[model samples]
Target: MNLQGIAAVVTGGGSGLGAATARELARRGAKVAVLDINAAAAQSVAEAIGGIACVCDITSPESVEAALARASAAHGAARVLMNVAGIGGAKRVVQRDGSAAPLEQFRRIVEVNLVGSYNVLRLAAAAMAKLDPLDDGERGVIVNTASAAAFDGQVGQAAYSASKGGVAAMTLPLARDLAQHGIRVLTIAPGLFLTPLLHELPEEVQRSLGESIPFPKRLGKPEEFAALAAHIAENAALNGEVIRIDGALRLPPR
Candidate 1:
């Protein structure tokens, strides 16, 4: 997979790691499609990268199908699908009032992070299966986003961790399932990073969080994540694994 002149679709392409990925893939000569629920945000990133933007809701099959169709119509069948669209929430199993956590919160997180990812993946794999294999007999590659909390979630992160945990757990089986189609699947579990949400916090809070990392003593960068994703797309043998780019920061029980 040279990635040159091939089509790549990036979900959550509006900002953060997804935006960085769309730019990196485009820089490598891939025709990119920025798929996101935020129409304005997706359009902005797409325009900046000279790519098309398709408003998508990954949890809905119809929405994903339409977005994929639009992407295919614009850039041909996408061989690189990046499942990055996700939401995060933190809640304890039992609140301070001794009441149970809201089930809807957990459901929403799982629906968006885990089920949503699978929705796009299934549809993308179907399209990729129909394409002719490249020189190495590879038809496509998919990279899913997980979180460090999946391994060691802090307090109030039950919902978030479970959703990301599902992502990490499915990497191997999904890779094996798609192996017959010449499509590889992998997951990236990122630790603390400076996403838009984190950036909004006070400077001292940000600094404190960065200092938690063992070696780097800083938060991860979106570009670093995008770089890893691009490398994963090019490397033929790096399938069915969940790679972590967390700067050696394991979450402490809060």
Candidate 2:
């Protein structure tokens, strides 16, 4: 599937990995839609890439529907969907004081990370299924963002890890379910990256985190993640797999 002149939708496109992917897609000639909860941030990225900006609440169907409508109206039905919008927080099952963690906290993370991703993927794939095949019966591709914490969650990350784990667990089954429609599904589980939030930390803290990686001794770059996503879109054979974009970093249990 060539990206040239095709419609692509990226959630969380306001910043971090999604923004990087949107830029890369635009560079490859794809008509991009930048979706984010923050209207201003989304608009900024969209403007930079000459794409449409759509404000969306990933956890709400109505919001997502409206966002997609605007995207499709402007760029046609999306053939590439990237589910990148998510939230994370650290909380143990039991607090340090021995009180049980609030169930709402866990639910919130799952709602935004796992359920939200599935919502966008389903909607985008439905649109993709209607389009004519581009090459070798391939109609579209969906790339989801997971995290290495899904596999090796440290202490105080129960909610965050579980949410990400659900994303990873669903990858293969989603690919299998959508295979008949000529759509491919893949997940990228990234390790520590210097995202905006992390970058705001003290310099020494950032360096300490980067030094923990097994190789390259630094955080992964958003552009690097975007580059792999571009490759997945072009290489039709790569499907039903979760690629780890970590620098061989196996998170240790805290």
Candidate 3:
């Protein structure tokens, strides 16, 4: 996958890792589609990259179908799919007062993170399967966003961890399933990165969090994530793998 003149789709391209990915793919000569739930954010990124903006909700089949159709309408079926849309949450099973945690919170996180990712991946892969193979019999590549919390779940991250864990666990099976179609699937479980989630904190708080990384003593950059995703698209042998982009940081149970 040279990425040159090929079509690519990036979910959650409104911000954070997804935005960076959309830009990177466009820079590599891919005709990129920026899909996001936020129309404004999607349009902003899309315009900056000279790509099309398709407002999308990854959790809905119809929504995803429409988005994929729109992307294809603008720039053929995408050979690259970046499943980077997700939500995060933190909650204990039992609150301090001993009340049970709201199940809705857990369900929402899993719905938007795990189910949403699968929804997008399935639809994208189906479209990719119909495309003619490129070099090495490769049709396309998909990169999913998981998290270090999937493995090193902190005390309050039950919902978030479970959702991300599902994403990580499904990598191999999905890759194997898509292999027949010459499509590859991979996941990236990033550690603490300077995503918008952490950007709202005070400067000292952010710095404190960054210092927790064993080395480098700083938060990971979104561009670093984008770089790895581009590499995965180019390296066909890297399928069915979940690469951790954490800076040697194993989150401690809070």
Cα lDDT, model 1, residue 200:
99
Which portions of model 3 show Cα errors greater than 4 Å? none
- Using lDDT as the yardstick, the better of models 1 and 2 is 1
The CA lDDT of each predicted structure is 0.95, 0.94, 0.95
**Cα lDDT, model 1, residue 93:** 90
lDDT of 2 by residue, 1-254 (tens): 89999999999999999999999999999999999999999999999999999999998989999999999999999999988899989888878899999999999999999999999998889989999998599999999999999999999898899999999999999999999999999999999988898989999999999999989899889999999998899889999999999999999998
On lDDT, the stronger of 2 and 3 is: 3
114: Cα error in model 3, Å: 0.5
Error of 3 at 31 (Å): 0.8
TM-score of candidate 3 versus the correct structure, residues matched by position: 0.99
**Candidate 3 at residue 147, lDDT?**
97
lDDT of 1 by residue, 1-254 (tens): 89899999999999988999999999999999999999999999999999999999999999999999999999999999999999998888998999999999999999999999999999999999999999999999999999999999999988899999999999999999999999999999999889999999999999999999997999899999999999999999999999999998889998
